[model samples]
Target: MIAFTAAEIADITNGRLAAEPGIIPGSVVTDSREATPGSLYVAKPGETADGHDFVAAAFDRGAVLALVEHDVADAAGHNYPAVVVQDSVLAMGALAAETVRRIRAAREADGQPLTVIGITGSAGKTTTKDLLAGILAAEGPTVAPQGSYNGEVGVPLTVFKADAHTRYLVIEMGATGVGHISYLADMVRPDIGVVLCVGTAHAGEFGGVENIALAKGELVEALPATGTAVLNLDDARVAAMAGRTRATVLGCTAQSAGDAQVRAGQVGLTPGGSPEFDLFLPGDPNGHHVSAKLIGAHHITNLLAAAGAAHAAGVPAGRIAESLSAQAAASRWRMERTERADGVTIINDAYNANPESMRAALRTLADLGRGRRTWAVLGAMLELGEDSIREHMAVGTQVVRLNISRLVVVGREARSLYVSAVNEGSWGNECVFAETVEDAYDLLQAELQPGDLVLFKSSNGIGLRHLGDRIALPPQAPGRTATEGSALL
Candidate 1:
């Protein structure tokens, strides 16, 4: 939002200026409730609600400029310059791109440049993104996408955060269908592309895994010749995309994949479920081992992806190792553990889950369970389309294969998992199906005993994190610890 006039905003978005507003400032906003002074509230027509209805409300709440799909009332004492466009959402995107250009110009004017890190993958992108931001912050100022804001609109908004002091910009790119990544790629044009292991995240949306590969590959496909593509060597599909880019390829592998540019060895889980490993980069003198504080073996691969990406961006091996150990989980969501007063430990992966990620989460629970009852409270994996049943069944089977003691499956679709598990050998007695979290919690109260290790996982739509919170902190009572509920056998 480098202070632009109504005329400038109209020109950038290719809209018609309704009136002349002198040097009126522009701060991009989509939500009218979040509108502030001198803000250019973009009234977008969405499936549920249209912002055009709130144009006057935005102006009343300090907004001086409006981007609308159609003419709105400038009546009722509301007098702000308006930009009428055929499509306000598209205009927001175009304006956001223009905003990024202005921000870059301001940074260049001050003789300082911003380095952007573009990350896209099926799983581990968020963790890797959080880790990358922390590592980048270790060196200098950095701004990462807050939460899962990594789409077309989010990408440019993230890029627009760049200023004179902003040094490194970490952008996470997420694709729902084909060509989504390409649009974001066309925006930031990151110097370092971290293509983490591509799995069946949105396989059904883009037809299949092959199309998913091509979609994620869009980020690195047009990278500058000198730019570097950081890929996961352990994932063959992502590894195969290396040569598809003009950028130099840097491969990250958790396993000793015989041939890899950057490999992680001597891997073992720390006492707190963190990973301790040695990172071997290309042409390095010996290797530097990292005792990472993040949870799960899957994180070993994520850490390598981040390190290799940073190395490709010119960070030396020694510095990358330091940055790896220096990294910590930003919150208590991803595999976060909390020991209840009843001695129950809850592992929360409720932020989001897919077939690949859910299996990794269950495996981590098996690896870290302290000879206690390992319980998995899983929810529906959304956006899988036609393959949802098969995928959920795979999750149920994986639970049995891992020898987890108890399974609490939530969500309507998860009933398929329960049915699949019931059909399997040695899994029928271990599985329990619930229609909702409330049902699951009721069953949990009756079935779970003290010392049971519980894991809560689901796509964000189900809000499965509530299960973790209820377990971690039941209503605090005097003489009762943070985890007050007593576990029953």
Candidate 2:
């Protein structure tokens, strides 16, 4: 973040300042523990906790100012140094928007272009952001979200991490409603936009799958006529977004999509379960063969989207392929692999799960579990709306068809999966519902053999990723119980 005085912040956020005019904050933060000297702590209210309760702690930790909805007084009965706004989260957005504008102007005056890429989709937003950031950072200073920080507050926090020295800014946009992406785009004003795909990850909140398409398309709709919109030609909903944007279209596909500018041919998975394909760029007849370090064949869509965005931002196709070939899964629990000394391989993709990602992870598990016993510890896929039971049953059917050796379905929310597997001819101990994470852990501990491959997958809210972490450890490594880990998460 650029240097800003208390008075400047008040003016930018349309808030009333209680602090001294000369006080300058070095950085902005929401968590009090992250507060440092000259840091501006945001006292924003959350679901279970109120930020106002932590203002004193933040001040004690060297924070110079607080952005709060109300003035918080010290023990001495005097108000603490702060900027009082109607809403601290919205104020954070204002500060973030101004920060981007200042950085953009500074880079332009220095005769260097600042390329901002806004990426959105129901799934793969974080992976695509990581891939693009890796490619961009190799060329210049790049700033991107920490993980899946793509919501309202998350987007602003991502921008606050940028400064005039940042040459490229990658913003991952996520939307649960129609105007969410548009609001985020107005803040960053990206030069290039990438729409990965519209899926049923949040179909409940968005009303339907078509509404998800409407929400995801807003990223491309926000692009300028002079900019480029990278559309996934492999997905019909994403490919149709080309007609929604005024910007030039750059289409990417895992297979030949006829008119797609960026394409991958000879797509297949490596022996290690990573995707390997021949990438073909526009105006280039020759294809660059790339063996990705990231696991899962479904990642081909993400790989192509990153390649198209990088190419549109002036990177050569060869360099893009090289950068991609070296990038692995940077975020946690998204097909993250761990090989234990006991000859057991744990693929932890429990950070998030939907119909699309769930299927993808299961396919990868089946592919990698060849010649070995496989265990899939799947939890609930939330927010499917009326299709919740159907989707869960479909996943169970896939598990059976894939010939997975065992199925340990955790939680009653996902009991439909166990039922479906049984109905699909998996009998007795072949598929069982553990009813709890601890029960699942005990079952696995009693039966897991060496050379077996296990996968843990669920939505973040379900906390299966923590269980995956515990399971990835050696049987005697001494870690929190699955239930305890899930509780902590």
Candidate 3:
């Protein structure tokens, strides 16, 4: 994203240049539709579509250069500027790494510090990233990824957004296997690494919970000796990572008494499920009490992690708590609460789901729905491999154990949940099974009453968030329904 000529980019990516050496791209893009003047388009071949097919389209949209597996001009007979490489995705990463190197160099030359913070976990990466970004932005220019852009390609795209004036970069690292996070960490070596928690979110992909811990610790492992490693004292697996990094270790916890250098005390939740707690930092006898606007008690740990990272970055404890209290949910479909005009409260947490996050959402629902009829519309938690059935059943049992009013399990993959709910003492319409989202929508429409609280949750691929969006819409007039709305539900 920093200015680079085609020749310089080719050298940075270790690829052959097929364009004039003087051509300089203003930005980088992967999708052809996002291409703008002086943009460098990276063509990646995905499972559904080959990006090489859109080379011409990208050029037509004012792209100055393209990174491809081969020169498009040779095959299509159109002379488009390109950087030929064996793999475009890897080349994009290389370019991003180089861009970060340049930004760091420029900051050092100007005698200003550039802090790169890396955050990783089985869950809560995006939420923590959003919280940390809010805290850091108060000090100077800060950049963070949009949504859940925390993967191989997404990490690089996020790094490319940084410029010379940027003081803090919050990189969310996600992994499905042992070396995934390690690979991303090598690109943007973080000065501050925050490990939220190691959970069963990707246990199946990583082979086990232990393996998930190994993958998530990669961020802390990448920190320099002078850097800071923020570890969660509550999660034993994450707490153990303190010994794995060479950086100065800072422990964060929601508990009042702990070995943690940064912690919270007198923790309580508001009626809306937002967290209120006394934030404690090192050497501070009288800590500041924070009332966060973000919903859910699960956010307590996330706030602690953000506070620890910000403290390590030289932010005052009071300012960190103040920034956190003023922050709202920046990412969609993650504890996004909406109250309908008809007195119904809809909590849409369908961005993604795993056992840990699923339980957190259920607990939040129980706490917020106290005295009101509660409905849980849940779909499958994908990538659980061997533990899928057991985890789903556990969630179903929790729904019953918590005395939630209704359990609506959508899709065949989630049938285990409904069966388990019924087996766990739910009876007579307490647990309903819907083969699709449409069926779940109809079931809710027919039975849902005023003052009911409903939660929609699932992995993003399951598409349950769309149902939450529909349910959040205002009530329609009598005998008048929008056909477009019904089509999606």
Off by over 4 Å in 3: 74-76, 480-483, 487-489
Query: Every model's Cα RMSD, please?
Result: 3.5, 1.8, 1.4
Clashing pairs in 2: none
Candidate 1 wrongly placed segments (more than 4 Å): 20-23, 74-79, 109-111, 426-429, 475-489
Q: Please say which candidate is ahead in TM-score: 1 or 2.
A: 2
Ranking by TM-score: 3, 2, 1
Which TM-score value belongs to model 2?
A: 0.97
The window of 10 residues in a row where model 2 has the poorest summed lDDT is: 480-489
Residue pairs in clash, model 1: none
Rank candidates by lDDT, best first.
2, 3, 1
- Per residue, candidate 1 scores C-alpha lDDT tens digits across 37-106 of 8777788877898888888788778887788877776776554578998887667667656665666677
lDDT of 2 by residue, 278-352 (tens): 998886779788899999999999999999999999988899999999998899999999998999899999999
Cα TM-score of candidate 3: 0.98
Query: How many angstroms is residue 141 displaced in model 3 relative to the true structure, after the best TM-score fit?
Result: 0.7
Candidate achieving higher lDDT, 1 or 3: 3
Ten consecutive residues with minimal summed lDDT in candidate 3? Answer: 480-489
TM-scores for all candidates: the values are: 0.92, 0.97, 0.98
Query: Pick by lDDT: which candidate is best?
Result: 2
- Model 3 misses residue 318 by how many Å? 1.0
